[model samples]
Target: MARVKKKIRQEQLIEKVKNKPFLTDEELAKQLDVSVQTIRLDRLELGIPELRGRIRKMAENAQNKVKAIQSNEVVGELIDLELGHSGISLLKITEDMVFGKTQIAKGHFMFSQADSLAMAIVDAPMAVTGVANVKYKVPVHVGEKLIAKAEIVKVRGNKYFIWVKTHNETQEVFRAKFIVVSWGEK
Candidate 1:
């Protein structure tokens, strides 16, 4: 019975990590109701790399595909990307990113994350946001991690319409629609 339960737990661990590769061992332990050491051991037995290695592998895959902006210029870490189609980025709000008193993150940081993601998805050598319609759904506090996903909706001539949604761990915190103009290979 113990072996059976261990097998089941290992399967759950694998599924959770497969779906959300960025989850740290601590987070995985919490979600699985297991100790972090157990999680690490399972990961080792399963041949799964640690969170940082997983993220680095993902970033390396997307780095070569980005064309509109330099990898370093992205407001957040670009974890997943498919040029001209969609992409995902992760940004963690820190002390310097939030207001000292309220602890609410500066709005521009969220906007930049979404905007830069929108620009990065354009299938051009270069792209710029000509217009942006955005809404801040809720205030995000420091220590919260934001996951922003961008999708290109339509294209007309040089203009690409992109929609980006930013979410904290719980719910959506921000969204934006952008009109990006692409420049032919620079």
Candidate 2:
């Protein structure tokens, strides 16, 4: 009976990680109602890497596909990319990114994350932002994770229109529309 339960729990663990690969061992343990050590052991048995390993694999795969900019130039960790179409990035708000008293993240950090994501989706050797229309919908605090997604809306000549929306865990915090110009090829 105990072995059967363990097998079932392991199956649940696999499914949970598949649905959300970024979950940490502590989070997984909480969700599974098991100890952190048990979660780690089960992950080993199931041949699953930890959260950082999983993120590194994702970043490596996405970085190889980037063309407009070097992967390291991305303002956040580039996790998904389809050149000329769409891309996604993740940013964690740290102490240095927020105001000293307000504890609210600086707007430039969010804009940079969105703008860079928009630039990355352009399939060109050189891409530069021509215009940016942005709005900060809500304030984000330190220790929060931000996910920015960018999509190309239209293309004309060497100009690309892209939209980026950034969300914290609970709600959308920022949005932008970018006009990008790209030329030549590397």
Candidate 3:
């Protein structure tokens, strides 16, 4: 059997927190039992940027600062636009996007990308992810570009079922079904 070799530095760290909650550099370093500098180095090499403004945008868009308060630091941006039932977004995965030495790209990052796009399409004051059924089809690599395409598949009262697909350049990388709950002053 051939061992799968990691092709990027971020991949090493991403493997550490695939399905887990997001963590800060200090927190991740401590959890992995490594030095902060080591974690920083890994992040720098993997092109993972800081996620400082991410929560702010989500808060502003959601119109609910309290709900947008995020405890993690994986940053992604909305690089595409569409409205009503469908939209697209692009997120640049950085070193902070990983966990240890595996390049799976943290699941939350992908989830956020999809969720945010869904919110954008819904054009509601606030949107929340109620549930999600996601499947990882291929491993995402460092320096690889990711694109998320989302569409509302169904809607019931405050709940909406959205379908999202994430891709890297040429292949479909991740797919998810998101159940989002949006609220506003009706």
Best by TM-score: 1
Q: Could you say which candidate leads in lDDT? A: 2
> Candidate 1: which pairs clash?
none
Q: What is the TM-score of each candidate against the true structure?
A: 0.80, 0.76, 0.56
TM-score, structure 2 vs. true: 0.76
Candidate 1 stretches with Cα past 4 Å from truth are 1-16, 24-42
Query: What is the full ranking by lDDT, best candidate first?
Result: 2, 1, 3
Ranking by TM-score: 1, 2, 3
Q: Estimate, for each residue in 1-186, the C-alpha lDDT of model 1 and write its tens digit.
A: 989989999999999988889889999999989899999999999999999999898889987788988987889899999888999999999999998888899999999999988988888998888999999999999889999999999999999999999999999999999999999864
Provide the lDDT at 71 for model 3.
16
Residues 145-164, candidate 2, lDDT per residue (tens digit)? 99999999999999999999
Q: Which segments of model 2 are wrong by more than 4 Å?
A: 1-20, 23-48
Per-candidate RMSD, Å: 3.0, 3.2, 15.1
Misplaced by over 4 Å in model 3 are 1-75
